[model samples]
Structures are given as structure tokens and as C-alpha cells.
Target: MQADAYADIPLPIDPSALAALIGGTTAGVGILDTKLRYLYVNPALERLNGIPAAEHLGRTVADVLPEIDAREDMMLAVLSDGMSREITSSGRTPAATGADRRYWHGTYHRLEVAGQVVGVAGIVLEVMASDEEQRRLDRTRHHLSLLDAANTRIGTTLDMDTTCAELVDLVVPGLADFATVEVFPPDVAPTVRPAPPGVFRMRRAALTAVPGLLERFARFGVAGDYIDHQPGSAVPRCLASNQLVVENLTDDEQLGRVAHCPERVAVYRALGMHSAVFLPVSVRSGPIGVLGLVRAGGSPPFTAEDVVVARELAARAAVDLDHARRFTHEHTIALELQRSLLSEPRPPHPHIEVATRYLPADRQVLVGGDWFDVIPLRDGRHLKAMGDVMGHGVEAAVAMSHYRSLLRLLADEDLPPHRILEQLDRMVERSGLDRAATCLLAVVDRSGGMCQVSSAGHLPPVFIEPGAAGARLGDVPAGPPLGTGFGGYRTTEVRCAPGTVLFMYTDGLVERRGEDIDVSVGRLRELTLPADGSLERLLDTVLDRFGPGAEDDIAVMTSRARPAPGGCAKDLV
Candidate 1:
């Protein structure tokens, strides 16, 4: 049978009977001409549209029910194809009924006479409750997706500014048209006490907005700028009350009050921002800052659902910010401690020129335990010591201090370099300092033209002759690292020609990942000394060649015995 075979059959009911049936039923029924102007509307439709039947005639659906999306496109499509279409639409209508917005399910079909299309007919029924439920489900799913994105996007680094930027980027053009994150300055602590009624201060950490509005919004404040909120402003109120503050800026006065400043009010008006939500970014450490969300022209005011999601996002971001805060605090203390403990070594004898350099690892790692010291001894000899404790951070740095103090005390006894290492190792073990360390000690005797060297599992020192083409590595005997409770260290003597330079450094100066230790050390041995033979210039050349790629902390020291008064030159050693 043909799809439209039933249309050829005659119906027992006539036009009057069909009109009475549609008019009497509760569902709305309407008919339109090819121009989509309504020709007939039953009493039910008049009630649904909140307009009388007489008023609806000769008017299009857009004219009578302009507030609702009645899907006129579907009617036109049905007229073109001679098929029926069912659609569900929701919007506000003039219906003074229950809710501000109403939903309806409608089916549209083409009307034909004499095998030519003349008009369209529609049946509509309200499906407000069921449609609302589906909308809620969809909104819930969208919220979950946003939260999942937050988890991956925010807190990727332990940096406060980066995290704040991530948070604002996630919500703009999705949850809001403009967003900002402001935090307390590092020197100030988050306090629960009510702020003074006159002014509230916070540093702007980040901000983001839709394309055209970002520049306009940035005129009010930029990141790292300190912003002050008025007494009754939304931000201060949100912080004081520990709750979200939603403002619909319906008038100039409302915008002024929420903006906290006249300049901001002008910007808000220019940008057409009419709605805002202020949420406190807080954790167990009281309220740290505030997050501001805004929506501009044509955007609906914030709803209760938006508040719930904004609260959750703020909570998650707060946790990450707190972690960053703590990390920053700890890092500052460690850096201070490392610097204080590693102050410039006391000036060695005027004849013995000393130059030193210390560089910490990258920001991701804390300060490490590399240290150097120059100690003046009897008989015109100066002891140059370089050592590295086995770890990074405060613990290793503190252990380095202990080892330096012990070495200085032992140096006062004027013992041989090997015996000093043996006694220092025993003292560290007995004192229960668990961290092991590698150290190289070189005692230069200018008057005798000889230097005694000892090693405790450390790299050999490099020696540069006054005019040599390349540097030579000292052949000091190796011993177990300090604090290992081993006492078999031996001392070696090397000829210290006048104007010869001795370079000592920690392992970080030459260590490279995935490369043999000998190869890494060889790269340093192949370098020529500066033509001027300046100790400072020699150290600079070494650092320039190898310092940029070092992944660990480095401490380097260079000392050269100048030509002694009335002393003749000796052969290179």
C-alpha cells in the first residue's frame, strides 16, 4: 500500500464534527495558512497562550506567543515535505500559570486540499514537569564534566600564579563571561577577624574573560596588583560572611555598590556586565582570597545551581593554593639557611688568591649540601676544603654545617690531611649524623712549594700550570666517604710550582645523567687555563663551559699561590 493511501479514503466525520472534537479536547489545536498566520485556534490553545481565541486569529505564532519558541521552522518543513514532525520546546510565555518558563510537545502536519498544500495544522500538549527533569539531568552531567576538567587543568605546578591562571581559564565562557582570582600577599596571613570597615586589600593573582571584554576588564586591575574593596562590597561581604554573594546589577546604584569603585563601575557598564557572584577561596587556614565571576549582556543572572558548582571549584582550587603557599614558605626558609651557612670563606693569605662560586639546582629541587671553606693554618699554609652531603634540602644543608665546624676544629690541631679525615669520620659516626659526604682537602704550603692532598670518596682536584696547554688531574688516593666509619685514608704530596692554580669542586660540577662519570670528568680536564692565569678567570671559564647543564648544586673553589717574594721559579708539576 502507498504511504498516503489512507488519505484517499473518506472519513465519516465532517468539518463541523472535527472542529467540535478539537475544540472540546484539553490539548491545544491550531491551524495556519502557508504564510504561517493562524486561521483557527481552539479554546485550549487560547488558555495555553494566555490569549483569547479572537485575539489569536490572523496572527502568526510569533505574534501571539512571541516569548515561547513554538518551532515555526518545523511547521515550514512539514509543509514542504508533506510529513508530520514532533518537537519539544521550552521558553517563557504570557501564560500567568505556575512557572515563569513552560515546556510543550507539539506535532505539526501539512494540510492539503485537491492534492495541493494549503496550510499547516498542529497539536500541542504541555510537558513541563518531565522536560524540567531532563534539563536538570543534562545540567548535572555538564557540571561533572567541568569538575573533571578542573582536576586535570589546575595545580599542574606548585606555582600560585599558574594555578590561579588555570582556574580562571577553566570557567570563562563556560560558567561565566569574566573571572578573577585575588589572593592575600605573601607577607600577610589569612585571618578570620572581620576586616576594618573602610578598606579591604588583596593582590590580584589572575583574570580571564571572553574575547572582546578582556581588555576592558583588565583596565580595572591586572595580576599582581593590589586591589582594595569598599566596606560593603561583594568581595569583602563574601569573605566576612564566609558565603557566596550573588548580585544582579539591575541599576547603576547596584553596579556601583558591587564594583567598590567608580572606575570599576564605569568599566562594568561599558562591558555590559549585569550579574556577578563572589565566592571565598578558603581552606582550613581561614579565608585566603576571593574568586569573582561575572556575566554580561544577554546572559541570565546566576542561579542556585551556579552557586553550588562555583563553590566546589573554589574549594578544589583553595586546596591546591594552600599546598603552593606551604611549599613557597618552606623553600624560602631553606634558601635562607643555605646562604647563611655558606657565607664567603674567610679571605685566605694575601699571597694565596682564592675565588669561589656556588650555584643551586633548579627551582623544583631545594638547596643542597655543597660547601667550601678556606682555613688559615700555621707555617703559612691554607687549607682549601670542598665537600657535598648526600642529599638536597634543609637536612642536607644542616649536616654540611656540622661537617664544616668539625673540620675547622680539627684543622687547629695541624694534623696531617689523612689523619684529619680519619678523626672527622669517627666523630661524625659517633655523633649519629647519618648522612654520608664526599670531601677533598688540599693544604697548600707556599714556603715549602708543596701541597698535601687527601680524598674521602671525592673527585681528584685539577691543576693548571702557569703556561700549560691543558689541565692535569691530581692523583690523590681515594678513601671511603666521611661518616662511613672507615679510617684508611692516605695523604699524597704534589709539587706546587709558583703561579700554579688548584681547582676543587663538588661532584655536581661534572656529573651528567646517562653519561659515564669518567667521561664527564674528562670534559673538564680537557679545558685550557686562561692566558692571564687569573684564578677568577679560570673558574669562570670552567663554569661557562659546564655550568649551564648541571642538574645538581655546585660549589667550586680555585686558589693559586702567587710568585713568592725573592723566590725563583720552579718546574711545572
Candidate 2:
């Protein structure tokens, strides 16, 4: 009477608990070993599978699953690693008498008992009401475009965490419902919730402190344990056996106690979500916390794809989360090192106020080569420069730092801006660093209201003063970017009016996939003259259209010349 590894696991939760957890009172769930043998069969699983628990006992999944043509690896994985899997058409396979077989998606969780891994627990559901017959085949046709967008989007993200979040956003909604992430330090409880506000920061803090908990969760058979904080007390569940609850709130005391329903009588009240579902967003690795997704109230139910999407997103999210934590740690060190290399802008000479913001390229360990600095010469002249190396990310960042240092040391020397570039070019080229970069440098004087600007393969600075609006400095661009072998440099003198503001940035701001420098230049002209606006606010709103965060990385530096007495000073924020 000895049943194999499939024996001895607990049965499904009682009817009361089940209704409290699942939003709708309809489905069933069960457990089976890698050999496809029934381990623990729930009453719901029996109802959906059309086989009574008494009959399914000790039977293999193949013998009982009439649907899945089981894969051997997926089977072994259940017992060996406690990995979960999905089979979407299980409900339709065994055509029930009269009712016929409705479609159901199945979600599985690897189960562990004793010190040994054993089987898999599963929940089945009818999903995707709009699906056509050719579901799997139809998705294949869109793979190329999906791959292109995925590759480009994923590649562009410099930060690992951003990349993961982007991935989840891209896949969910269409693929599943809400996606939640939880990260925690070793031996600590996860503190996070989707909220009225302030929740994002809490989630971030948990991840930063715990290094690789996210990534490790993706691999099968993570080792650890789970604790259920029940009202009566608490119970510990095996690491491999994730605890899942499905509850329809209509007749549930626990649901009432939790106040699961808020707008019980509202016309726009949520449905299908009247049923509640709770599961750990965690794996056995370290202490990544639980993720709970509550369905909309008065809704039908949580389908198989719903759970599948959550798990897959969780798998991908794990990579992102770990990377974000690690990246944060690393960025702190790099930013600290970089700050010392950059220049401190001189106080506005009673005429100018300047605000500068620098963002490192988003991906890779390589620092970006974008750099900016403001220097006040002994002659009371202001020196400003912004540059972008050919590549983005950490390596570019390191190079940018190096160039900033060299330029800082040269500022005190009696060299012209052109000569500085010539020397820096030789340094970059001969250093054999193989890194190429572009730069725009300018000099301004408060007393003279005169300006000098030079460019080396960089976006020309936008010059805006009262009345004249934005003008491009430097008639002829200086030689090739610093790292380019054959290059030239030129300078132009401009009579800048007092109260003029000069905006300089790396090419990132004006660059789009197919547009040229002229397009951005034309657009900038239109933007600057916008009847009225603060330079900072304008910069914030306009640049963001094609700038960082939602787009590519951007570096900006703005300096304005003061207004002359008796002249109408244009007040701009």
C-alpha cells in the first residue's frame, strides 16, 4: 500500500477557504508527480478533470490528463526540480457528457515534501474568451516584428531593472492581468503594496538591499520555506510547495474580514474580481517576498493564462530585479567617482542662472562618455562644454570622466578651445582606447555680452536671448569628433544680448531613428519662441518628448546671460 513520491501531500483547502481565495466559486485544482502520477488531488481538480479524486489516486498524469501529450523533461522537472509548467487545452480534452469540454488553461507549481522534491500542483481555468481556433499558430506569424521590437527595446535599456520592468509592461495586459514584484533581504519580511502612493520606493529599497534574490528565483527548485500569516496564527509551507488560495467573496468570512470589497453597491464596481486569489510571488531562493494579485470584483474568474503570465513575468522580472539591485550598487560607486572628475559651475555673475542635469547612459557597466562643465576663467570669461562619445553606457561614461579631467587641467592653461580639442583628439586617438566622442564648447563673458562657440561633431547649442530667440552658434562645425582621425576646428564670435540663455546638449535630445540634425534644429527654433515659458520647464517638457527615461539617454546644460538695466526682462521659469 505504499504509493511512490506522489503520496502524502495534503488535500485541497476546505470549501470555506477555497471560496475566500478564488474570486468566483467555479474551478478545481490538483497535484501530480513527474511520472504523471496523481500525488494530491483536490476536489476542484476532480470536478474540472471529470475524474473523482478517489479514482485518480496513484495514477500518472498521462493516465489521467487525457489532454497533454506530456514532455518527459517537464515531467522529470516536476519531481527533480519542482519546476512548474502550463498546458492550455486541458479542459477541452475530456469532453464531459452533455456539457462538452470547455477550454481550460492549466497552471502548475512544483511540489516538495519531506526533504525531497515530489510533484506539481495545478489550477485549471477557461480563458481568453476572444481566442480564435488558430491561437498558437497565429502568434508565430508575429514573431519577427516582436523580435525586432524586443531586441531594440531590450538592447537600448542600459539599466537592468528598467529593462525588466519594460519587459513586463510590454508583455502583460495583452498576456495577463496585473504584474507585481516583491524583493526582500535575507531574514526579512517583504514590505510592499500597490497603493495610494509611496509604494514604488518601498519596492525598490527591498531589492537594493538583497543582491541576487530575484535572478535566483527564476531557476527551478530554489531552496527555502514559506510562512502563512493566518488570523489564528501562522503555518509554514515547504519551499517547493507554494501556497495558493482562490476565494469568491460572496459568502466568505475571511474576505469580509479583509474588507476585500470597497464599492459593493457602486455602478462601476469591479466584477470577476469579487473572487480573490493569493499566491507568493516568491521562489525558494533567498527571501524575495510574496506578490498578491487581486482580481476585479464581480468578475468571472482567474484563468490559466492569468497565472501563467504572472509566473513567466515573474521569471523575467527576477533577472531585471537582480540586475537593478546590483546596478544601483555599482552606479553609486561610479557616480561618486565621476562627480570628482566634473567641474563646478561658477556662480551666476549677477547676470546668469544655470541648471545642469546629467544622466548616465541606461545600460551596461560602461559609463557613458557624455560630459559637461562650466569654468570661470581668470579674465571673468565663462567656459562651457558638453560632449557625447560614439557609444553609450559605462565604457562611454568612464571615457567621459577621463576627458573631463583632461579638460579641467587644460582650462587654466593658455590654450584656445580649438587647440584643446586638437590635443584631446591626439590623446584619445593615441591612447588607443578606440573610443570616439563628439563635443561642443563655448565661452561667454557677462561684461562684454559677447560669445564664442565651437563644435566638434556635436549638436549646435541653441542660443536664445530677448527678441532674437534661438540661434545656432559656430557657423562652421569644428573638425571631426575628438576621436576621429581627420578633423578640423572652427570658432565663431556672436554678439549675444544681455539676458540671453544658451542651451547645449549631447545629440541625444534631437536624435530620432530617421531624423537628421536639421530637423531637430528647426524644431528647437519653434520651441524656443513659444510665446512664453521658463527655460527649465520648457526644457523639461520639450526634451522629454524625445529624451531620456521613456526614450534614449540625454545630457543638458543651460546658462543664461543677465538682463541689462531699464530693458524689459523677460521672466521665464
Candidate 3:
């Protein structure tokens, strides 16, 4: 039949033909009057709703399918504007043919006669199977995205607290409404014993929550505070079993049991928290801690898929926490070793005053091998030394101690500055110390009124006259660094007037990347000397000027000869 002929067939169509067409198609078809009351329902729609046609006619959608959200508002919009509308909805129906929750796509259009509003015509198709598959794919993609983000955001620093904070920050308001990370104390080994039956202790490392809940949740425990989980708590259970514990707090009793405390239960009620999950943070060693995730009002209870995502996140965070713990332990041991090796220098003779300062590099870098010492020599003279081993960490620190001990033994020989460095270089090379070192040495003879300075691939020493306004770098001869077995070192004699200050330092104080060593040294020489002639104040000013920018370990020492009483040098001790 032609399209125009089909339209001209009749003003009121045959009911049997329309029924046959609606019944033959798979889509569910229905007609609702202006009041949204069902006026007609075909066999397909009856099957979709699990109700016969007689039971659906003359009843509203809410009366027939209360569980399903038919979106009456969209149907009303179609009737008011005579416009068509489409919607995708999900809910359980009486049919129970597939998943508990089924999806459907529906299209609704206005039905009018004589250009006056009459009713709405709706056709719906069951999309449960395909929509379920699409939902699974979307969830998988979301989980993968979270894992990828964890790789870069978590463990960005080798610090325990920082790693903990990163883990919680990544999960809050995305995976959970609130999250917390708590770990066994440093002195307590995670695998040593099962959690106590009465109470379990763990230190809170990090906590984060959705806006408006952070401050309230923080009342339970802040980071660094020790929290004791009461008996039968999910955290303790998760730790002991090394598994996940999920709680759906649907009632006051369930909330009380999961909260483990009356105060927390009240907080939960106020915040409308209804679901929680506790997962063990574990590695090959054992369970190290627990990760807690919670969801509040209107948010769905934790599901199996959510548990899977949270478990993966906890596992990744566990590895990072383990690494941070190990790093912190090593850093502590190295720092102590360096400090012990760099003890205060021995006091020089009464005529000589000396001051020294040692600063390790930033926390990200391990302690380095920088050392300073002052040793008394024969004839009222003192030997001052500053040296830097060419690396960082425990091995460099050990080498530094070796150099310091060997230098003390050679100082007893009353050797000059150059001879001392030559002997040190030979001994270090023979001792199998592979790391090279730069060193500056000065022999101050107060009565002789002259100081002998030498260098072993080290920076030149700076000197300030008693009354001079500015400092000047000493023109000391340089040689190969210690451990090279080179003997080209030559001593430069600088006049040591009464109250003259001799400053010696390692390269960390004056070296900058991409800048010539000479230019860096020039910057140091241009600094005005402190007028009080106090060696302590002189070293303080130098550090205040350059210490903040140093990228390596620094060791600096200053020595000044005191003027003899009555202007008679021979009378001094």
C-alpha cells in the first residue's frame, strides 16, 4: 500500500490490527491518559511487567510496577509539549528473568486528536544483558585508571608518612567517602604476634575524607596518634585473618558493632555512614597495617567489585610503605655514623682559637664524608684540616673516619702541611680506599707569626687581616686528590699576624653546578670580614651567607692566633 493510502484508510483505526502490530513486536508498548493512568497495555508490556493486560489497564504505573522508576515526569513533559522524549532506567521488575537489577530504554511520544492533548504512547526495549556488559567494561576501565594513578601519585617520596598520606588522598571521594591508613609502630614488628584479644594498637599515619567530614572524623585520631581498636573490631579482625572485612551498617545495632565505641557510633549516625571496609596492608613479610574505607548517606553499600579495587590499592600502598620503612632505617644509621665520626675538634693551644661547623645535605640525600679536625703539634703550633670524600652514605663515612685516624698518627711526626698530605695520599692509596678525597690543611705557628697552607685538589683557603675590610683567597699550590698517590703538593706560607683569621672549607660551601670553581671562589673572597676578629662569628657569617643553598655536605673551620700580652711573642707559652 502507498504511504498516503495507509494514512487515508480511516479516522479511527481498527483495534484488532493495532493490537496485532503491538503484540508481534518485542518492544513493550503501552498508552497512558493525561493523568498518567494506563489506558491500554499490549501482551509484551504485560509480560515485561509480569502482569496480565487486564491487571494493568486503568491503573497508574506506580500501582502496577512500584519497584521500577517509569519516569512519570518525562511522560508528563511529552503530554504537555506534544514532544517526544527518551530515557534509560534501571530497577527490578516482577519478571525476575535475568539480573536482579535490569535496564530498559524507553521512547515516549504525545498522542493527540483534533490538535488537543489526549495521552502518551511509550515503547520500551529490555537492554539488561548489553547494558550489564557495558557497565562491567566501564567499571574495569575505572579500576585500571585508579591503579595507573597510584603508580605515580603514591610512593613519590621514600618517607613513611608521606606515602601513607598519598594513599588516602588517592582514594577519598573516589573510592570511598572517608579513608584512613594505620600501621604498627616502628618498635613493633607486624608479624611478631597476633592482635591482643582485648585491644589492638596501631598508629594513625594518614586520614582523608570528603568535604565537611574531615574535621569531624579527625576527632577519632589524627596522624601520628596511637589508636586502640576495641575487641571484635573490623580492623583487628582484618589484621589477624589477613583478609578483608566488610560491614553494611543498616541499623543502629550493626553500626554499634562495627564502630567498636559508643562515641564513634554517634559520629557515624551524625555523618550518615552506612558502609565500611577494612583491608589488610600486607606484603611477603606479613600484614603491616590496615586500610579503612567508609561510605556515608545515600552512597551504596560496599560491593564485591569495590572490595577488589580497594584490595589492589592496599597492596600497592603496602609495597611503598615497606620501602619507606627500610629507607628511613638506613638513613638513621648513616646519619649517626657520620655524626660520631665528625666529633668536635680538639682544643688548640691557648694562643689559638678555632671554630668549626658541619652540615649534612638535604634529607633526600644520604649523609656524606666531610670531616674537620684540629691537632696540636710541637713548638706551640696547631694543625687544622678540612676534607671531603667524593661520595655519600655509610661507605664514604667509614672512609672519612679512616682518613681522620691516619692524619692524627702522622701529625705526631711534626710534618709540614705538604708532607702531611703526601703521607696521607700514600697511606690512603695503600689502604685500598677506592674513593678519592679533596683536603685542605693549615699549620698555624703562633710564635713564628706565619701559617703553612696546602691543598690536595681542594679549594684555596681564605684569610682576613686583623683590621682589613675584606677577605682574600690564599694562593695555595694544588695537587692530585688524596688516594691518587701523587706527591706534587707544595705549601704556601701566609703571614699570620696577630688576630688574623684563616678559614678552610670543603667544596660544598663554594661550588655551584655549571659555574666555574674560580668564579665561586671569587664570590667568597668578596664577602666583607667581620670586624670583631671572633673566629666563631666569622664562621657564622659565612654559613649564614651560603649554607641555605648548599647541595652537598659542608665542613668549615676557622682559626685565629691571639695577640701575645705586652707585645712580646717570646713570653707566650
- How close is every model to the real structure, measured as TM-score? 0.72, 0.51, 0.74
Name the candidate, 2 or 3, with the larger lDDT value: 3
Write the number of the candidate with greater lDDT, choosing between 1 and 2: 1
Give model 2's TM-score versus the native structure: 0.51
Ranking by lDDT: 1, 3, 2
Q: How do the residues 206-289 of candidate 2 rate in per-residue lDDT, one tens digit apiece?
A: 111012222432321122222213232101121124554445545434354323232232311222234444444343454243
lDDT of each: 0.83, 0.55, 0.82
Candidate 1 per-residue lDDT, tens place, 469-550, comes to 7788898988999999977999999877777778889988889999999898887667677777677787788888888888
Residues 1-573 of candidate 3 have per-residue lDDT tens digits of 111212322322345777666767778888777888777777778788888777776678989888888888888989888789997877888887766787789999988777867788889988976677898899788878898999999999888889999999999877999999998877523244455667778888999999878888877778987777887778878888999888888788778767755568777888899999999999999988999999997778877888999999999999999988887777778888888888988667766667888876666678889999999888777888889999999999999999999999999999999999999999999999999999989887767767888999999888776677678888887899999987799999986666667788888888888889899898877655566556777778888888887899888987666555566433111
Model 3 lDDT, full chain set: 0.82
Q: Candidate 3: TM-score?
A: 0.74
**Candidate 2 Cα outliers beyond 4 Å, as residue runs:** 1-181, 185-287, 293-344, 348-350, 359-367, 430-432, 469-473, 485-487, 527-534, 544-551, 563-573
Candidates by TM-score, descending order: 3, 1, 2
Q: Model 1: runs farther than 4 Å from truth? A: 1-48, 51-120, 123-145, 172-178, 187-201, 207-234, 248-275, 294-306, 351-353, 447-450, 464-470, 495-501, 526-551, 561-573
Name the weakest run of 10 consecutive residues (lDDT summed) in model 1. 1-10
Q: Model 1, clash count?
A: 0
